[model samples]
Target chain A: MQISTEELPGGVTRVRLDGRMDIAGAQSVDLKMNIVAGSAHRLLIDLEKVEFLGSMGLRSIVIPARAVHSRGGKVVLFAPTPMVESVLKTSGIDALLPVHHSLDAAIAALE
Target chain B: MLGLLAASMPEALSAWPDPRLTLTSQLEDLALVLPWLQALADRYALTASTRFAIQLCLEEALSNIVRHGYRGRANQSITVECAPSPAGELVFTIEDHAPPFDPLAPSAADAAPTPQSIDELQPGGQGIRLMRRFSSRIAWEPTPSGNRLTLAFPLAR
Candidate 1:
């Protein structure tokens, strides 16, 4: 798994994730995601490139989102493929970490 | 780590072909099993939903074995077999030599909680829930040797 971070306008941080987010993949990004959540005010995760998402991957996202929410920040997800999105919904992560299809809408929601 | 040992399918599951792996009681071995599952998924042309279900179920089952079934043990072994039944159902049989434990039992506290609040949500407890939610059918048996778990996913569903 690979994660690249970009700072957008208005202090929103976008983290683009690529590859499968299974056990190994989640482990690779766990520490780094927490670190990014600490530094950013609002976080947007791009799951367009994530091919497979397991429960462990869900935890990777939830942990960081919890960290950000604890500090009054927000986090959202956008562009997850249908399979990845279904996994999110089945596990109830969709309610916790909202998902948006449009980039602009995601940015607006986070803002 | 996970070592892929070539093992023949058992008598009851002989109808399915040769996508089999034997893993050690190690968490990292799960990494090796994903590709094996992907190969089977592709060979059978499983749908996106089926593929995801297979991946999640395998991960959850194996992780449970590593974390709970073989807790604090070493050099234990788990065997996994994957194939499509003649009725076009994705089949997975996981056999473990750890203590006789039924992962599907209702008393397993590791089952994922439906999060009402962020404070109630946890990261690690979702595996068993995912396994139960995604697969069409699951059966567990505890034998004198150890335990056997059979999971089936409908191809059309």
Candidate 2:
């Protein structure tokens, strides 16, 4: 898994995550993402390239999202593949961290 | 031209071999089985939904054995068998030499009402819930040494 972040004009940060979010992949990114989500005011994660999403992957997202929420920040997921999207929906993580199909919608949601 | 190329291609390329994996009941071993599972999914041409279900179920079962069943023990064998059944369904059997644990048995918490809010969400147990939701048929049998869990998944239409 690969995680790269870009700072938007505002305090929003766009984090692009590619590859499977399986057990190994989640471990690679969880610590870094938690730190990122902890500091950012608004965070957007792009899951367009993520090929798989498992329970551990859900933990990676949920933990960081909760951290951000606790700090009065917001975190959103965008463009998850169909498979990943279904996993998110089935696991009920979508209720806590909203998912969007487009960048505009994700940014707007964070607003 | 396309037809001629197709006919010339080797049958080995078209045929899918069944994927079987054996790993020890260690959390790190979870990584080793992933590629084999992916090969099984690719071989059978599993749809997105089916693949997701299989992965989730396997992770839940394997992780449970590693985390709770074995409980710091090492060198325990966890065998996994996945193949297409004669009846056209995907069958997966996981055998582990840990203490007998029946994931299908409903817990006391199962009878409780669903949480109305996320804050009230339980800390654990979601894995077993997901496995039950995804597998079409699930059965458990106690082996001489440990337990065996069998799961059948339907093909995507």
Candidate 3:
């Protein structure tokens, strides 16, 4: 999986994730987050292009959500695909986490 | 800390503190863990609706790990981890050292069941499909050793 990281306004880092996010898919994301761990104020992961999100993928998101939040920052998920939407909903993240429908919409919320 | 336990524990497949009893790793162990996993959900004293979903998810997931992950390799080892979340939730994890495989890939068909019992609907690859639908959170990580799969469920209220 390839995850593109872009610096966005309002101190938010926009991550454009593409490809399958699963068991073999977590290493890169974990590495990416570790690189930007303390440098940014927030991270908005763009899931629009992500073709798949599985249990392991959800954990990847949750770990970052907890890790970033603990540092007094936050991680926002943007535009998850339908496959991811059900997982988020069943996991209750759809209601608990901040998920946006578009990157622009997500960036706007950070401001 | 976890490695210490694995190293010191006696080799017992059906008993406690056995890190080797993963559902995906060994098909025979499925019966060992399935009943207990179900019993935990039952002990939750949850409403029927929630209990059914939980049971379905747990059973199917364990089955998937056994049938899909291990791929019938002899002497396979799948690690199943169940821990309690700080929020009083049950977090069940299954990991295995097999060839790289992702069971959650979306199938070509995206249609609803033709009205069968949720359990009987047996949505083909739906065990995992429902696991993602039923659990609070599911995550995976590939270690140098194997694939680490974790499923978290909120305790019944």
* Model 1 C-alpha lDDT per residue in residues B1-157, reported as the tens digit of each score: 1122224434344343457898898888888887787667766778878888888888888888888889947679999987668877878999998889877778773566678766566887777777877889888999788999999998764
Per-residue lDDT tens digits for candidate 2, residues A65-107, read: 7677778888889999877887776666677678999788899
Per-residue error for A3 in candidate 3, Å, reads: 1.4
Better of 1 and 3 by lDDT: 1
Instruction: Report the C-alpha displacement of residue B124, candidate 2, in angstroms.
Output: 5.2
Query: Model 2 TM-score?
Result: 0.85
Task: Kindly report which residue stretches of model 2 are placed more than 4 angstroms away from their true locations once superposed.
Answer: B1-9, B12-19, B108-124, B155-157
Tell me what TM-score chain B of candidate 1 gets against the true chain B. Answer: 0.81
Candidate 1 residue pairs in backbone clash: none
Candidate 3: tens digits of C-alpha lDDT, residues A1-111: 887788865778877788756445665687775666556668887888876565556666766665665677766788886656755665545554578886677777666
lDDT of 1 at A50: 96
Task: Please give the TM-score for the first chain of candidate 2.
Answer: 0.96
Ranking by DockQ: 1, 2, 3
Model 3 per-residue lDDT at A65: 62
Q: Clashing pairs in model 3? A: A55-B138, A55-B139, A56-B139, A56-B140, B22-B78, B24-B65, B25-B78
User: Can you write out model 1's per-residue Cα lDDT over A3-91, one digit (the tens) per residue?
Assistant: 99999998899999999898899999998898998878799999999998888899899988888888899899999998789888877
Q: After best superposition, candidate 2 residue B43: deviation in angstroms?
A: 3.3
User: What is candidate 3's lDDT per residue for B1-157, written digit by digit as tens?
Assistant: 8777777874542244433344335545554764565555555555544544554455556556556666666567766666667887777777667766555444412333332321222214334556766777877677786677677777757
